[model samples]
Target: MHYLLPARLDLQAHLSAWPPTEVPQFHPDALVRLLHLVTEVPAHNRKLAKQIRQQGGYVPLSAQLLQSIERHYNHYLTYAVRSGLLETDGRWWPTTAQVAGKCRGYRFTAAYCTPHPDASSDEVARQPRLQLVHLTDPKMQAKARRQGRRPTLLSPAERRDLRLREQPHAPLLEWLAPNRTPLRLDQAAALAYLAERFDMLPPVVAPRPKWPEWRPKWLKALDRDYYASPVEQYNQRLHSIVRLANRQLQPSIDTTVGRLHTTLTNMSSELRPFVYADGYGPLVSIDLVNSQPYLANLLWNPAFYTKSSSVKSTINFQNFRQSEIYKGRNVKGIIKEIPDIMLVNISQLTHREDIRLFSSFTGSGQFYELLLNAFRQRDVTLTTRKEVKELVFQVLFTRNGYYSPYKALFCLLFPTVDHIFRLLKQQDHTLLPRLLQALEAYLFLHVISRRVARTWPQVPLFTVHDSLVVPQEYAGQVEQIVREELRQATGIEPTLKHEQWSQAVRHDLLPPTSVASSIELNKKNR
Candidate 1:
């Protein structure tokens, strides 16, 4: 009996020409479904609609995406467009063209539905209830099922799915809901300040240089996969952040990797200054310096993996190596020996000078700088810390078979560490990033956030991956706690950096000509 329908009426009556039994053209429910879809971006939420308007107010619609919902979607869409119920905008290009087919932006015509004017609280409450699209009719339900669509939202499972789509995950929902401990946002004030200055900053896309034949092979793959340039991607993310701010609702949250993904985390570093912790006033973010490399240092110790939530392998190293040897594996050849060779390497890990140096670099928060300096020494094309960091990530996260001269230099510098990285990726290339992210989530979410909440019940806490966001007043105490927890967990003193969330991005703070320069400038300013 449960169904989702548009809150307002479609005054155009676009499907009136078609009879109920019509075929190969418009169905009786065609207009209703199209209205349902066209209005789907805002979903009857006025705040969401206003926010979406900041991003040009169009919904990206593709024949491929629509066809996934039903087979005859094209005809239905064409009918709606010709009937003047819908209008098309320019083509929508996503980050990658391969992941999605051609998409055309679409929005509902004013003839389709009347816009609701801003009303007072009493007037809003007095408004009529949303009209429901009931599939109580057996024929309608059967037709929906035939199209591989949901027939009813009556079931508990269906309702649950709907709720999830409307709100955030359970734990994040509890934190965001209207309560004493609400995760508040001073969005109205923030957006007003941001809107005045955001458009002034021109997009600063980096120039794409032609790939030299002698360049690293992985660079080719990376460039090929990314359809848009760095600045274009940055602008895209910036617009999205602006749209998110316009909502003025509870910020959306994702519990992916056990981390809270709010608008704060999603926005560019340049835009971070405008947002605050609502009633608690201005906030500060304490970032874990060289988070990934620092976390990877833990992998050097065999005992860490057993205790890690993401990687809990208790296999005996000696037995594992013996088994590999017994299976006629080439034990003498390091690369061909075993994927779990890190286990065997742990015995002599402490003796390696390179391992000790790597630990020192990560601990002192100079991992990226160290790589940058080394790449510069080798006269590699990389110039900034950002480029060096990306190169290192590609090497660490990409498949072991991926060829790169930069990776070769890394191997030359830290033979033991590079060997461990190759061994870790032998089984699955994705294991490294996934394991590191999981460890990061455990460290920040389970360890730091939990400890902070337990100690200071009044302080509002949020997370941006490896970093922790709290009010400025409690920063020192929180920093101390973070330091203690990290050292206790990893047995290494980590370098932590703090950045305050301000109300504006100053003139000098404007993004520079290239992403690399912008990053370097931001680092220096921080």
Candidate 2:
């Protein structure tokens, strides 16, 4: 270790000569405003964005703060969700803060901005440039420290100082896809076909209100008549108690025990008063700390909400009809059905179909039909068995590395794409059973033909779900086969490929007929 030791005085002098580092633009008010937005008892993303937007006068917001705002809002929205601050059907919206300003932390007040009202050509000629003054107010710095936010934007010099401070960001890199696609499949066509063949999957079930109840005086409610409620928490908890009691009351010839909602009347004292959601239109709910259901936020439902085009939250409102609870106590005892075997099977299948279609496919129709349609237009010409194996390999372990993320080649080769992709995270292992199932099914009823099931000597083409990549000249032949096979498998008549898919499909195939009906968007699936 040969180092120069006598240079301390010179080093100190040199350091003293360096310019001061620039501070990021921070204001005391920003932190205060943000705290008000976020800690709003039950912080919400929409509410936060809205609040920011409401402060019409410019606030010094920055990109960093905006990002934090969205992040924290999401955090609190999740909180409100778990706390039952919202109803079972409640949704989140942005607070006013998110949209009002371009930068999240940078604010432009008349004082900070140039004196010129407008910066036009003449203003530019006047050399009217405004200089930014770094803030040094101790109070503002203290506020920034409390909120765990950076006091100002980091200039190059200040950023270097952060390095000196020993905090650093994670290294970022772009992991390449290696080979994405030279040819493409029509996911839209596939989804549409699937939706037609199989119905749209059922969404999550939520409890609704029962029929109207006689509004008793507020004092009378507290007094508790014999028929009055004793609070209970959660739908399932109430259900279990009611069901057990119903078993006790079972269609018997007792003196006087027709026990309708008997268990509901016996809830814990702390929970009974909040049981009435009938008067409230729609409320958002959160689950427990363990993700179990608990009531959350309640929003006033507008008569107009039911008509929105995109049925995100609107579906909750529309679902109120089938729900007996939504009808309230006045309509409770008219009639009910126990649900026989046929209905139960039908319901289970319908729900499963919904989940598969919704989760497996993105952007529309259904899952299975899309597969049939896409295969129809594809040219599956196979000279030998090698092509099939290659195709299968491409589908399964499509990525070059062991730890690579799931890729699109997944569409073609692997059958259990979902299972295989997900299982990568686990230490447990399994052979490609589901993939075997999918391939066996795909291979069983299918063959290369001019048209589907046409049984040509040469295997001309194959389909993987809804994607079909075939020669332009073979479009007509592929189209005919797709419709025939689709009908054969699903029992639904097939529509034109163009009608079923995105209009912007790079037509390697010839154009076909168009049908007037189908939602215009029902676009390409994933």
Model 2 lDDT at residue 232: 11
The parts of candidate 1 lying over 4 Å away from their true place are 1-173, 178-256, 305-340, 374-382, 505-526
Candidate 1 residue 170 Cα shift, in angstroms, is: 7.9
Best candidate according to lDDT: 1
Give the alpha carbon lDDT tens digit for every residue of 93-155 in model 2: 345755532332212222222222222332110101111112245664454334432222224
Best by TM-score: 1
lDDT of each: 0.55, 0.26
Error of 1 at 277 (Å): 2.1
Lowest lDDT 10-residue stretch of candidate 2: 290-299
RMSD, each candidate, Å?
Answer: 14.8, 30.2
lDDT at residue 355 of model 1 (Cα atoms): 84
